[model samples]
Target: MNSAVIRLTKCSSTKCLAMFQLSYHSQPKVALDEGISSHRVQVGPHRLHYLRAGHGPHTLLLIPGVLGFGWSNFKHQLLGFDRDLFTTIAFDPPGNGYSRPPEKTFPPLEVEAETVAQFMEALGVESASVLGYSSGGRTAMVLAALHQRLVKKLVLASTHAFILPDEYKYSRSLDCIEETWNEKEKNILYGVYGKENLPKLWRQFNDFNERILKEQRGNICLHLLKDIKCPTQLICGQKDPLTKVENSWLLHALIENSRIHVYPEGKHSNQIKYAEDFNMRVQDFLMADEELSGTNIREEDIKLAKANSF
Candidate 1:
């Protein structure tokens, strides 16, 4: 990995473009029970793949992990959220799954969040509830802190608000996933990561972990937790190896209006593994916060969000 891939963005973009995906990924398949559609939108110079389902009153964004795509990660929710209650949207972040890279990599965490906000703006969504699982939760935090007005509510599951130095080595160890993967899992990996590019992908993961633990350690916006005004819920599986349950508790204690949901037998991908429970809890929260109270996101704030380009 080069230094460029690890550098953060510092430009702010106020523009929006509806784009399309030029690539595809092996994603978990699940049929939408009702009106659902796929869409592509431009964020800066990249095109993002996302899913749209239902016509509920509230807008909810389901953000996936590093390798998790919009549809595959939230397959269970494609038709789970009733059309009369919520409009659910999920997206493949840059450098992940179906959203291929013209940039060849992802932007900084800050830039990623702003790009997501711009994606919503491009789609004419003024504000939305955000749910980020694992890495996506970190993005949700940045969105809440900097682009405060765009998030109506928040749900973070197995998120990384802070990463310790040791965590880098632990993250690097994840490359062995390919070694133990079953045929089905291997197929998924082949579809999303490609078989020929395994070595390159592993190197990229190592490089990313090094940069995260060394260059960007403890910078997952924990300091900005106080700035996030939307009602937040932090969740974690008790047995999670990557991110501990205590981290969620710490996040709960920091965010003024935040709460916590701990899963006794949950792991890093608990939300997806326990999709039914997670979705149920998410719906319950969103329903209760129907009139979600938060600082109004203004045009100026959205501009400020763009200014965070690395």
Candidate 2:
């Protein structure tokens, strides 16, 4: 993959517009208050909506990716995990889905990550295992770095610590924006199979992309990556264009306890594409009864699981 000559024709032009409007506000699978439940909690100046599920000794938290909707993001992993083993929590970040929009400055990844900690405190949860995908990966990373005592394990999927390879400008380039816009958002839905793979879901995709573009600007929070000391796992889709597979490799190199896994031919939606494998790796990591004197979970395993049952 020549970082320079990346051809995103499939995601460029009107297709980018189509991808910008993707929405997951009321996904059928996100049934809160039962197997899954939604709640509103105060974080800083905003009221955030989060989903809760299962009830067990182990608590698991999931963070959505850039443009990621709550249920739409981790729905697949939720289906794979044995609910009896753990309790799971997923939330809509400020300005997305059922959560209130951020005031003045959009909730940066760092602030959102801190808010996640505050959210747990309000729920009487002392600690939990954290999983983050894409942009959510950054949030999980921030949690581990700042609130080390609260995170039992960390999983990062298709994630990056910093905008790396300065020469690799896909995301920073106008082409990236144009490419994402090409996909209509209305048809972009995420499920166990990944990104819904629908060609006409333009509005759904666009709305998501638009939100990330606006909110994520100057908000990536890369400075905290090296500070993370939790058990960590990293997963990457071999064919991911939005964030290169190399990003995973870079993360593994940076996070002290990190490990890496790459699925050949898997793209940005690989977590959903390979949901079973993702869940298995996560379960194994959480099952480890290691002393928490330090982060025992390795980095390579980060992306192995995204939304396992708590």
Candidate 3:
């Protein structure tokens, strides 16, 4: 079938929510033998790089934290989850992956959020569920809170609603990358962000630990979190030093209709270590028939999975 133009009703504000029409041009399903495929779309000045797996009814966008790319961070989800149930897209925010930023100051939250919305629009997606890890999780919150119609459900792992302390300044200190990291974590970092400074396609993360704090300027989405009415899930490791388990509790407290999961003995990179269980839980949450919405936490929503000791 020939690809057709996606008509987005022009909105006065560039960052309009799911305000326009999306052509119901059904995306082709991925064959069982097919592997994940890379995709690119012009989102404003940046060209976003994302990987698409599955062609199911529900759309799920995976956003990664600082020093991480969606394709690398959420690979298991694309490979392991029931793709027939949901189409998943893992994206690299501007500068992190192949999505290059314009030459100027790095963009702030509003800009980043706009990029996400425009990205969806480019792909003819009126709205989709968003799953963000670490800093990207906070971005997902902003996307849902500010652009309500654009997100159906939210899954936030290793995310927080609070801003860094005033004294927190990062200069390749890997601050946003999480200080409580192991060698495996370091390898992931080096591979994703530091591979080719000027040597090739990776340079954005070479500048800071987390670019958002320094470059992006907008409310940290804390104020509008309660305003988010979508069914949300909050996840974190009990031992994540950068974003503590208590922070996850804070998000759970503020966001109504939210569930919380704490992986015992898990670190900031627990998502990588526990991919199977983590992806399963996320899929279950997204595909669940019934989810209660309120500040009240359900017994099952609270998971305290213990990590095995070495």
Instruction: Report clash pairs, candidate 1.
Output: 8-310, 9-309, 9-310, 10-309, 10-310, 11-309, 12-306, 149-297
Taking all chains together, each candidate's TM-score versus the true structure is 0.79, 0.68, 0.72
Write candidate 3's Cα lDDT for 19-124 as tens digits.
2211223212222224456666877767777778887999999998765776558767777778788888888787764454432234556677888898899999
Scored by CA lDDT, what does every candidate get? 0.70, 0.63, 0.66
> In candidate 2, what are the lDDT values of residues 51-168, reduced to their tens digit?
6667767888888875566667877766567688988788777655545343112455567777888888888889999988887887788889989999988988887654443313
Worst 10-residue stretch by lDDT in candidate 1? 1-10
| Clash count, one per candidate | 8, 65, 2
Q: lDDT for model 1, please.
A: 0.70
Sorting all predicted structures by lDDT, with the top scorer first, yields: 1, 3, 2
Candidate 3 regions with alpha-carbon error over 4 angstroms: 1-33, 101-106, 164-219, 295-310
- Cα error, candidate 2, residue 160 (Å): 0.4
User: Quick one: RMSD of model 2?
Assistant: 12.6
Question: Tens digit of lDDT per residue, candidate 1, span 17-91?
Answer: 222323343333333333667767877776777788888889999898766677667777765777788998888
TM-score, prediction 1 = 0.79
Order of candidates by TM-score, top first? 1, 3, 2
